[model samples]
Target: MVAKNQTVVTEFLLLGFGDLHDLKFLLFAFLLIIYVMALTGNALVIVLVMIGQNLRSPMYFFLSQLSLSEFLFTSNILPGMLWLTLAGGGKISIIRCFSQFYLLAVCTVTQCLLLTIMSFDRYVAICKPLHYTIIMTFGLQLQIVTLCWSTGFILSIVLFGFLYRLEFCGPDTINHFYCDIGPVLELSCSDISSTKLVTSMLSTPLVVCPFVLITATYISIFNTILKISSSIRRQKAFSTCSSHLTVVCLYFGSLASIYIFSPKIGSNTKKNLSLIYILVTPIFNPLIYSLRNQDIRGAITKYIHLIGTWQLP
Candidate 1:
């Protein structure tokens, strides 16, 4: 039974950080710094991977992809959030909301799939050191990366197709910094059983299944590392896995906290978790990789010296 006065919502008011009226500028400034660091750091990784001959391995290839995905992921969400923070709050058209949601979902799923592939790469490298080159050939790596990206885009379109069909008839406020599936669905007037089902189906394959695979891969990697006869080799193996493990923990931990357990938590808590998931993780990725990786650090140093020599004249 539809109300006679009910009408489709043309726009949604994003709550953003409106409650922090006194601290909006401070918040904006802080996030602005984070945004710049994230972009610069990820961009540096991409450039290093592209130009450094020593970084032409499968590991650095996947790292470059991860950095590129992080760039797009942050870009899609942060600029709009920064604007909202500067303005205190703002209305976004329904189309724009859906577009932002679609891009975010695509990048998120792509990153998950890419991370799984990288874990497999690590597994092959550590567990089968003799055959690493044969197994992780450039052709195979290309196929896997293409599959990850294509599947992510396809799944995103399917989810968006279903979501776009939902009706929003009043109460057109989104209680978050950006348009996420949960917040957007909360405002839908139409029945959401189908949407929920689709989300569950996609989420399991995109997040949970990949997470399990990554865990198993790391387990195999650790088992192999334990069998190494040399202590130095063992330390080297641990160093290689540590950075990826840190990122995995942060990425999946924040995601599960927000999407899985957030129902029992407060909105403020959820918002903060979203900030970590969306903002902080990307910024920390390059720092973790560069600081922990001798290869990356060496490449950066070499490039810096080259630039310094060029500028000396």
Candidate 2:
């Protein structure tokens, strides 16, 4: 093992949004605002769901978990990206890089699974009311949530392990914003064909299967709504599902466009689409879900008023 004399790279330059050199400061400030809002908004969702007695249902419970994941996910990627934008270079050690990649993969995949699980929960309640309680029992809900996170971590480590073995000869500049697997893999000098193939194949199960399941769940949900005799009942169902469906479409569409289809496209296109999910989707989740849901709106209004009316003396 002493024959090796290779100099390892100590840092990587992330060319995230690298084209707009002039607007880095402007973009940094703008993104900082969005990051703050996302953190506060999602945190608030978690707090409300946990504290409010009315939100004791499985749906709100899962929403709270989704909010928790989004908060951590945003924190994981955005701070480093912001630093890179300001400092011109962001250095991550080799071990740190692999750790970040694994965390990112776990969080990203968990969110995907959580969204699908949430959709299924809604589908059962709306389309199969008679069996909703029995099917979505507390123990089963806990199991589904646990499985989503566990599977995400298991897959993350497997993919990252293969990536860790490749040798990076040169061109240490990563093409995208974060330490995403694709750009890092492109840097490796060693034979990575099998790793590449495995990554793509591994991703398909997490990305495509869940999406198909979500689509199918919605199809049945919509069918049940259409069959409802009362227009008011149909409207109620649409009102609830509309916000959730909108979030699903935006998240799934952007995710598939970037990670699932990056093989067909190059880095630039992939990075552009990646922003939709990584940067923009977190900002959109609370807006789409909380703004339209009447209960959430009331809770938010009461929160604002309570804060506003409180004063010393």
Candidate 3:
């Protein structure tokens, strides 16, 4: 049934950088460099978090999970984009498209929950320091991580599972680099009312709710800090959450913009907005987290110094 239903659309032609013959090589090189950077940087973060005992904190644990998810995300989309760009254009199979959406949703929802959980972690440490350890125990952390991934899988099944059921009777071209939901839905032949509705619901928690939680958590943290006695402790607590805050704002602000005015917006705007997270986020995340973190900075320095000493030997 799927084969017959999907016959009308064997593959989707990605309409990425269509008029950039002159810049294709340049763009390819640029994207490849970022892809490598993203992979290496995030991998380094995970390693540092794992290998460095100094980084064995609840915050770094959450960060390791984020780094892992971002690693998978970049692995999925960037390499494919690089190949397609080099090939001068490409098509993704229907099944592959659905798979992309499923995996993407899984990571995305995991990220949302992780960030929200990180916010709560900050809230606990800042507002209720005496009980922080008890509240964010190892078991509790494991449960939260499991819940994030599981929720992502369930909602993805609800969203893209139905997407797979939709017929694509015409214009099977996707105007973006990957199988983003907006472009894929635009290409579907059947009624997309339910699709739009489901998208809104799925997107709401991922976008609005976590953002609200992050915002609220920060506000309360700020309010609480004003009452703290120690300047050194207050500064330390502030620095701890700043990296996460920068990333949350960068991600949430742009995501809200795109979804808030989607479809009615043109392809170019959508593409530009997608770049904020897809390409930029992964690049910026390491820079933000590592540079801002004293321990991570020391780890990188020790790594470099160790490498230097070994090199001369």
Candidate 4:
């Protein structure tokens, strides 16, 4: 299978944010702070959901899972990106590149499925309040979370297999900070039309179908809220859905901007847009939820007080 005349590239040079040549250190510092805050925020959400008695509902349980997904997703990319930024661009082995892409893809699909499930959870809670307990039972929640993660891994493995089979014969310079599918595919010497087709087919269901479902679910949710004649009750109902809506808008907006409409965007602009979902969304999740939800705020207060009591000497 080896071609004697061909030279396969074993590694790639990531250009990173090299255009800002004089600001590499500043960029590195900024990313480092973002990485720390994101990890702390997501970890806080997970801990609060786990230990806080008031946060034992299906919604909080799902929030914890989302936080875990965000935790892994950000951790997968940010460290390497920090290194790339600090080093003013760097080399990544093909295996490392593939592994990073695989992990990112897995997390992306998992979060998408999780968000869709969360919207359905909200729909059932708001639209069918009496049957919410009966429908979203603990066992069912576990199954749904499991299914999301399992499907994400299975789909990403298929993509990984295709990526592994692609031959990169020469000129392996990736124009972006990470081994995003687009940039990686651009470097392949092999015919990747089929890869693109398969990717589009796989991605449409995961991305488009879930987004469509979320939109439909929210439409029904808003309709149910509007039917409530009591203004206080309407406000209460809207409050429950607002945080999730904010996150969905931020996540899907950045994702669509980068992947769906990125063909018309410049490379540097795409990289900047990529940071919204990658760095900004994770940092915002805890703030949005904790700041807006009385339950989470009360949990945080109770948690801090409990810790203070335990520290007394």
Cα lDDT of model 4 by residue, 1-313, tens digit: 3367989899999988786676887888899999999999999999989888889899999999999989998899999999888788899999999999999999999999989999999999999999999999999999999999999899999999999999988788888888899889988888899899888888767778889999999999999999999999999999999999999999988888888888898988889899887889999988999999999999889878987889546
On lDDT, the leading prediction is: 4
Identify the superior model by TM-score, candidate 1 or candidate 3.
Answer: 1
Better of 1 and 2 by lDDT: 1
> Each candidate's lDDT (Cα)?
0.90, 0.83, 0.85, 0.91
Each model's TM-score?
Answer: 0.97, 0.93, 0.94, 0.97
Summed over model 4, clashes come to 0
Structural RMSD, model 1: 1.3
With a 3 Å backbone cut-off (N, CA, C), the pairs that clash in candidate 3 are: none
> RMSD in Å for candidate 2, one decimal?
2.0
| Model 2: pairs clashing at backbone N, Cα or C within 3 Å | none
Tell me the lDDT of model 2 at 3. 21
lDDT of 2 at 123: 94
Model 4 CA deviation exceeding 4 Å by range: 1-3, 19-22
Residues 1-313, candidate 3: write the lDDT tens digits: 2345455776889877676887899999999999999999999999999989798878888999988888988898898888878877788898998898788777888888888988998899999999989888899888988887788789888987779778786688877888888888887778888988988877876898899888999999999987888999889988988999999988777777777666678888888888876898888888899889999999999988988888542
Clashes of 1: 0
- Candidate 2: lDDT of 120? 91
Where model 3 places Cα greater than 4 Å from the true spot, the runs are 1-7, 311-313
Tens digit per residue, CA lDDT, model 2, 1-313: 1125655566666766665577889989987998999899899999888777667788887888888888988998889888877766566766677787888889888988999998998998998899999998989988988998898889998988898787775668887778888888887777889998998888777788988999999999999999999999999998988888888888888988877777899878887888888878888888777888887877777878988999999
